[model samples]
Target: MRTTATSRPTSVHLFCGAGGDSDGFRRAGFDVVLGANHWQKAVDTHAVNFPEAEHLCVDLDHYDMRKLPKARVLVGSPICTEGSPADGIKRPKAAPTPGQLSLLDEGPIADAAWERTRATAYDILRATEVHDFDAVVCENVPRFATAWPLFHWWLQGMAILGYRHQVVSVSAAHIGGENNPHAPQWRDRIFIVFTRQSMRQPDLAVRPPAWCPTCEQDIQAVQSWRNGRTIGKYRQQYDYRCPNGATCGHRIVEPYVRPAASAIDWTDTGIRIGDRPHHGRGPLAASTLRKIRLGLEKHRVPALVAVNHSDPGDGRAVPAHASPLATRTVRIGDGIALPAPFITEHRGGGSTTRAIADPLGAITAGGNHHGLVIPYRKGGPTTTAYPLHTIATRESAGLVLGSDALPEDIALEDCYFRMLSPREHLRGQRFTDDYTVLGNGGEQTMQAGNAVPSNVAQWIASALLEVL
Candidate 1:
């Protein structure tokens, strides 16, 4: 723990789940002096990792920020269950989505939790007014900004506090880029950066200002694939291009698409070329046809690599990884399935037979029967929500085995897969190895899944320094 005098710009973290945000700021030289969270286990974990910071196990609903030591910087991640799209709360002002309805079934426990957690957002305003901090950072799901009156309230509150704020959606993976090999996880979050009128600097944004040219072409190819709107008319346009000529357009589609699997699923029966499914491009080469057929049967994601002589010309639509273009459809259920390396199998206690759960379901904070099943000689799921704690011991890390060898192991039947350990989760969040998770597997898993990746926090911290 590094101690600092009052003269240094100090930071206090609210809702500090396992201190991932503070760890990033600490890495960037911020004196993270204090933190407060409701979960005792998480607070204990935060204390273990950030020994010097004052950790308080207090609920934000009734907690007062002024009672604590004052600091120049304030950072927080308000409870997101009520605002996260994943939780089925699509619109901020609307009642809980059906998915969220489960919480309401438990009477006061769920209802009260929702009410109290929802108010945590206003706690930021309270901290700003009471502490007179020079800057405030509130991190949460992107929907937090547009969740009905919530965004309006945040904007109005900051205005009352006489601070100007900017909301930027940043990707942790993009910020880390190629330099930080440890920071490849795809995590996107909305950061509301507020600064006192005194600081002078341009606002910060990690999103690329421009893309490569070949990437632009790829984007057009994807846009045209959309049956509804054309790429030119689409509002959110990316201008970046591949630095290399057409030969290397990998970067264009890299960030948007998950890695390829050996097999894939196509949307239409008749193979059409060009962006529109109707526009025909004569006959594809026999080799191209063979690869497409093989990819579909083998469950492999088609390649979007650099265009080669054997490749179809630019602007032509081909069977490939699911793209932003393919995602845009008039009908909700209409979409193609890309190749997957493995299938996610939720473990069951019974013998002989078990069922697979939703592939992209929320990774709850426990080691229950949930795990992934990697295909033989193929790959695994693209999503990172699955943790490494599928097995009870550390030796299981990176150990893929057949289910028949251990007949009782239901998650691994015909395919082979391994659960990611808590340490691996920390790495995905860009936390240093020394950072400790002080609890059982469930508590630790929750901390990792719910955390705002530290890499993003570090980028925001560095940006905050410029304004301060």
Candidate 2:
């Protein structure tokens, strides 16, 4: 076990999906003594990455907390799907009954299984009741705050157990860089810390100014709040703007926010849209085709475009080179589009994509839905430059200048499309290159989506270490 200036602090992670949090804690110099989860595959992945840590693949809901080993810190990312807005389930309008803490005797929630899953928060209480840790950190979606009353009740339970808690909202993109690792994706989450000792809240404010390619100047962030509450619903609490009055929109200037282009493998240019048979699907969906065309028109060059298949309004094409990818979900929502006739080689290669214009989006537990689009050139060997590149071969390859072609001139026959690979998704999640993710493509994607950005975890762990 790795030791710090004080000593090796032990941590136990509950609902440790693929060990993203575990990995981060380890990096922050904590001894991750145990990781517990319900899914066997998740357990196996955690085991593979953290062989020294003991793992339990049992349902946390039914498992006896008394059996868990004692540790200095406890970390948990309870099942959040039931409480997430992405699930599409209408949340109850009424607050949960004051004293009815048991899911079996639920008053407001109707779904028993969802109640059980949501009750996982109470599992932290259960664990604390079993063993008194120095501190406890619980991570969940920002929307999890919507259950204010129940959340307060959980805090009250902690207070009764002699632990004071603080709720802080943070984004992975805003935290790490320089000497620390940073996730390419923009994921906003709330970390509630329960400490037995009194310590000021950890400083989770945005770290430094980011370069605004649009404004061509370094921009800072302006935090938005109203009457001591966050300005917008869900993840908006983590967003900030430049106080310097930069005209480049009020987007958060995250210098630490890495781009999606860093995660893409240009050599893996997917199959041509025209060549691949869609079987009975009848050519790509009109919506998808329209997105591609729209992307082409918007970019006006051989560019990387993300075609979102889920919500049309949300599905607008983004220049892959200039924008961080939108959140990755379990369902295949976003797809990549490229103008056609571009040759691809089996060996990996780089593209001429530029920095992402927007912040990276959150990754969910479903699967990789982000897609890429590339422009295809008709003839001759093409080389990587500006926005496009052709397959590398023994023959000399040069820039194709496909941008000269107007969007109107580009036809459906001129593009290629494919989903982003799982490895790329993992990169966006900030997992190490040596990290092993076991499973098929879909499962791997699911694990990546579910994972906490390890860098974010490391930041949180490092902060907790100072206070612990």
Best TM-score among the predictions, by candidate number: 2
Candidate 2 structure quality by residue, lDDT tens digits, 27-48: 9989888988766677789999
* Model 2 ranges with Cα > 4 A deviation: 1-6, 82-119, 199-201, 211-222, 226-228, 231-256, 278-282, 301-360, 380-408
Worst 10 residues of 2 by lDDT: 388-397
Which sections of candidate 1 miss by over 4 Å?
1-8, 82-119, 177-182, 208-371, 377-412
Worst ten-residue run, lDDT, model 1? 259-268
Residue-level lDDT of model 1, residues 82-170, one tens digit each, is 44442345554433322111222222222222233323677888888888788888887665655435567667888788788877665
lDDT of each: 0.48, 0.59
TM-score of every candidate relative to the true structure: 0.59, 0.72
Residue 200's C-alpha lDDT in candidate 2? 56
